[model samples]
Target: MRCEIPILLRCCFCFPLRYGLLVWAYLKQISSISFSTVMIIKLCHDYYRIQASGAVISSLIILLMILDIAFNVLFIISAHKKDYKKMRIFYRYSIAVLCLNVAIVGFCIAMYAYYVYVAPIMIIFIWSFMVPTLVMIIVMVFLQGYLIILVRSEFIKLKNNSQFEFVNHGADEKCTANLDFVKEIPGTV
Candidate 1:
């Protein structure tokens, strides 16, 4: 089923067995560069300094992605199971949480962008590596929540529409059946 694919991908992302292999490749590439080359030296220095933290952030993002995927899978399954009432409630809560997340991400990104581009004239700490990393982490967190909410809301809307259609169809069928029965009866008039 289409729902199961997301779950499998979620498991893979959570464990990150594939990501580990990608990191290993990057490490090998770094190691292969000759140290005697000046460009290689600069590259190695920047790579080691920035990429150490980047790896941690990337791992966290991947984990959150897995969670997002899992939530989507669950939402799809729940909707398919005819759990419309619960799905609607879940969707409303998800929207609220996602809106909060979007606000936080927007604030963090704005602050970080200003710090990077404009804050140098006004503040010293804003330029620090830690601030940017923290902002990035917050952004990733918000993004994951936002994605989950989007998927859940979409599924909820679709399921609700389908439920309405099903009910309407049943009613139409019953009406037609009643008309057929009435016609078949002996005329008393």
Candidate 2:
């Protein structure tokens, strides 16, 4: 049996079931909305650290967060309806989001590298302005990766604990599927 993570909060604080996943989804949705809003507002004010071009970058980040919210909503619906397959869709979506987060962090690091090597900027300016933003994105990427693991654990637990009816996918040579007999007859004979 696959080892399961019982709790989402620091690995040992919360419900032992998929409820942790429900809390995780809600927390992610709220944080994404609030963080995106705060980033937009900050971008508007901090014209030195972030310029008009930063608006486009921040918009792209916001768009990704919005997509995350949509997936969380779908996850909520799936869990409420006990649709484990749809829940698995959210698992796959989380993996994709983690990849996106990694890409964003890589792009940000590359931009910093360009500022350092290709066109040297004031060390103080880059350190004071760009460093914080890069750090924030990197932290988000790590958090996303951690959440992916937590969600995966929950999925594994669900798959293991749940009962499923097994079906034979073989050729119905005797048309056993079509048989609707009035009496219980031995099909083997």
How many clashes (backbone atoms < 3 Å, residues ≥3 apart in a chain or on different chains) does model 2 have? 0
Per-residue lDDT of model 2, residues 53-121, tens digit only:
877788787787778778889988876776768778998997887787788778878878877887675
Report the Cα lDDT for residue 96, model 2. 83
Candidate 1, residues 65-162, lDDT tens digits: the string is 44444444444455456455545655665566567566766776677677667656544665575567666767756655544544454454556567
Cα shift from native, residue 51, model 2 (Å): 8.7
TM-score for each model = 0.33, 0.64
Q: How many clashing pairs per prediction, in order?
A: 0, 0
Residue pairs with backbone atoms closer than 3 Å in model 2 (clashes) = none
Q: Which stretches of candidate 1 lie over 4 Å from their true place?
A: 1-50, 85-93, 109-189
lDDT of 1 at 28: 30
